[model samples]
Target: MGRGDKKSKKGKITKGSYGNARNRKAIKAKLKRTASKKTAAPADGATKQKRTIKKKAEA
Candidate 1:
């Protein structure tokens, strides 16, 4: 019939209730893991040294 009836048929509660703290924490942890993977920096330390040497040569 309506949206509520459809959800009930699927055995899902489409209402916003409290006590979702665990769900929120799990979502935040997942986001942090994904963000860390995307922003990973290079491990080699030579690039920084090369930049400094080039700057000194120019001066």
Candidate 2:
């Protein structure tokens, strides 16, 4: 059978598979960790300055 004609016994939809509950939870947890890392404190003045600039632009 061709790829498009094949069926998954697990009932998964290939496109936008993150709609699956397990996948969605995993993705959300990963994003939370990434966002925390990004917003973590800067070690030096230059990085803090850049962050202030970004916040101002966002505001």
Candidate 3:
């Protein structure tokens, strides 16, 4: 198997495609990051600050 071999990593990269040869770690990591972000809770007082709207005086 050489660079032109489809089953090899180099071949996959040369072909600009992904499969079992490329290992799906990147996909798995992305999924984990998204899941953690969704399940993560903000600490007390760490939540986003509320915005106060100013009322204009009537002329």
CA shift of 38, model 3, Å: 24
Backbone clash total, candidate 2? 0
- The number of the candidate with the highest lDDT is 3
On TM-score, the stronger of 1 and 3 is: 3
Candidate with best TM-score: 2
Clash tally, candidates in order? 0, 0, 0
lDDT of 3 by residue, 2-47 (tens): 7899999899888877899886788679899999998888877477
Assess the local accuracy of residue 1 in candidate 3 as a C-alpha lDDT between 0 and 100: 77
Task: Extract clashing residue pairs from model 1.
Answer: none
Q: How accurate is candidate 2 locally (lDDT)?
A: 0.55
Rank ordering of all candidates by TM-score, starting from the highest = 2, 3, 1
What is the C-alpha local distance difference test score of candidate 1? 0.52
Per-residue CA lDDT of model 1 for 1-59, tens digit only, reads 33354334222234432134225466679999999986887787434454444445665
Candidate 2 at 49: error in angstroms?
17
CA RMSD of all predictions? 12.6, 11.0, 9.2
**Per-residue lDDT of model 2, residues 1-59, tens digit only:** 22232243233334334444336678789999999998887677465334444445665
